[model samples]
Target chain A: MIPGTPNTVALGIGAALGLTLAVAILVLIRRDHLYIRQALWWVAVAAVALAVGVFPAGMDYVGRALGILYPPMLAAVIAIVAMLIKILLQDVAITRQERQIRRLAQELAMRAESPSSKDIS
Target chain B: MQDTLIVIPAKNEAATISGVIAEVRAATSLPLLLVDDGSADDTAKIARAAGAIVLTPPLHLGAWGAIQTGLRYALERDYRRVVTLDADGQHEARWIPDLLAVLDGDAADLAIGAFPERGSAARQVAWALFRRITGLGFEDLTSGFRAYNAKAIALLAGEEATLLDYQDVGVLLLARSAKLRIVEVPVKMRLRTTGPSRIFSSWWVVTKYMLETVLLCFAHWNRTGRQRT
Candidate 1:
């Protein structure tokens, strides 16, 4: 219901791009390449892309509401910011996993070095 | 079993590991455990031959990680105290008693074996800068030679200390935050006979260390006061 003159060509390209992303994400999730916890974010991103593609004028409304001079730049800015945040979250997850792996490695080494463990071998 | 366990964290120190182990054996009969930090050389084999139980991590855990592994081992064994020695042969075993004595006297929960004479000009500047930022009064802040009582060991072995890459400021800051009694025991250290300094191996590493340490100092300054206790 957003009001704007949406060009047919632009609408077709946007819809195709959104549909491709959505299908790709679903395929990845189905293949078990992406965990549910991580896939949730990608699902939301794909949903957003689909929504924007169906309603390109919505971006204009939001951008104008936010007082942006050029509405199209809003999408670019949001995508960049979202990507940065996603990358940062990945790093946080990596740090936690790294810490866990280190502790596990320590435990393994200690257990292997124990006299009883040596006796078993 | 002796209450105090000597833990040495060595990385590719095959050339010096045997000598260091021998020196420690000569100084004290306390049980020794060497955390072989994924050394490609025969550090583990040599250390075993030298009468030290060695823990070889599946992968490299850096210096602090290796030390923490030993601390965790000591914690699990209910050891009353732990003395950490660097495997570079710099940390002399003769000072082991002095550090343990400080802990035994209940003078401090953590005793740092300090040797200010070891700092070169560049090291002195770095030390001064770190001192100014962190407000730590110890002359030798980066000395790996240290004694930790049970309380300190428990604290450092916990999850809160796993992310620390260096044993210098990050560790001291954690100890400071926990209000552990810390004292410096003057001791002489041997000059490095092997590779270059780990922390100051290159200019790029030095810059990274400085920035990261300064950030750590500022991050904890609010929670932990500038008290020189």
Candidate 2:
């Protein structure tokens, strides 16, 4: 016995789309074109999208709780929020590294300008 | 190379830096190490004239970054103790010895000059919120007046500290996480010789600072596995 789905065709399409996205991400990572650190987040997002597509009932339950008539719209909303958070975290990380690199450069310059450098000994 | 070194981190404090340097000189005859954090003014020239060895970073890296630079310099020179204060003349140099006394007492690896009545209802409330969240018992969370031993200097000068935006809360959390003792001594801080406090300059800045600090606290808490969740 199996549970019923309102639209099996749409669910199948969503699952296929998510699987394709995950595969593409993996291929990019394997080819060394993409950093694993960043690609992992996309992979997780793809996995979640696939699960929601396969077992749409979970999202349907959530959409109904949130009073959204359409479940696919809910998936889209979740995907947007996830992407925004990923972008924000990356921005913070990059900003921090920028400061670090600048400081390192300055420290090196200061060391160079000092005539009586300690490293010479 | 010295037993005790006073490291001051300055940025665009040309107005009152010479006075601050003279104050430090009056208090102790120890070596003065001034880290100029890319000030556009004549801060480097003034500091040099005041007899402080000035090390100017090629670019602006903010207070914490400058302090880290000074700490690394101290570590390289093998200073046993280091005292750091603001260059805006807000932090009194006379309190330096008191802070060092705490380090000498073997009670703390780091000592902070804390003012319990640094007064501002909003500021107190913010400190209260952080106290409740981080469970850190320091009265002054934003004080730049602090003293550090070799261990604290080594830890702060490393890669782990480079990512921090603010020195106060982040440094406290890092020191506590490393099981290093942090002590506080009662000290009076004067009004800023320059303009208003940068942290409280605008509502938007305050909101952004709060958001970043809360995120940092959560990240550290998770890494330390201190939370039950």
Best by lDDT: 1
Q: Give the alpha carbon lDDT tens digit for every residue of A1-121 in model 1.
A: 4456787888989988898899999999999999999999999999999989988999989999999999989999999999999999999999999999999999998888945224321
Model 1 residue runs over 4 Å out of place are A1-4, A114-121, B227-229
RMSD of 2: 6.6
Candidate 2 C-alpha lDDT tens digits along B111-185: 999986865888898888877678788899988899999889889878888777667888898988888899889
Clashes of 1: 0
- Mind sharing the TM-score for model 2? 0.72
Q: Per-residue lDDT of B1-229 in model 1, one digit per residue for the tens?
A: 6898899999889999999989998999988899999788998888887778888889789999999999999999899999999998999999999999999999999999999999899999989998998888889899899999999999999998998998898899899889999999999999999999898888999999989988989999966788543
Query: Each candidate's DockQ score against the native complex?
Result: 0.45, 0.16
Report the Cα lDDT for residue A42, model 2.
77
Model 2's alpha-carbon lDDT is 0.83
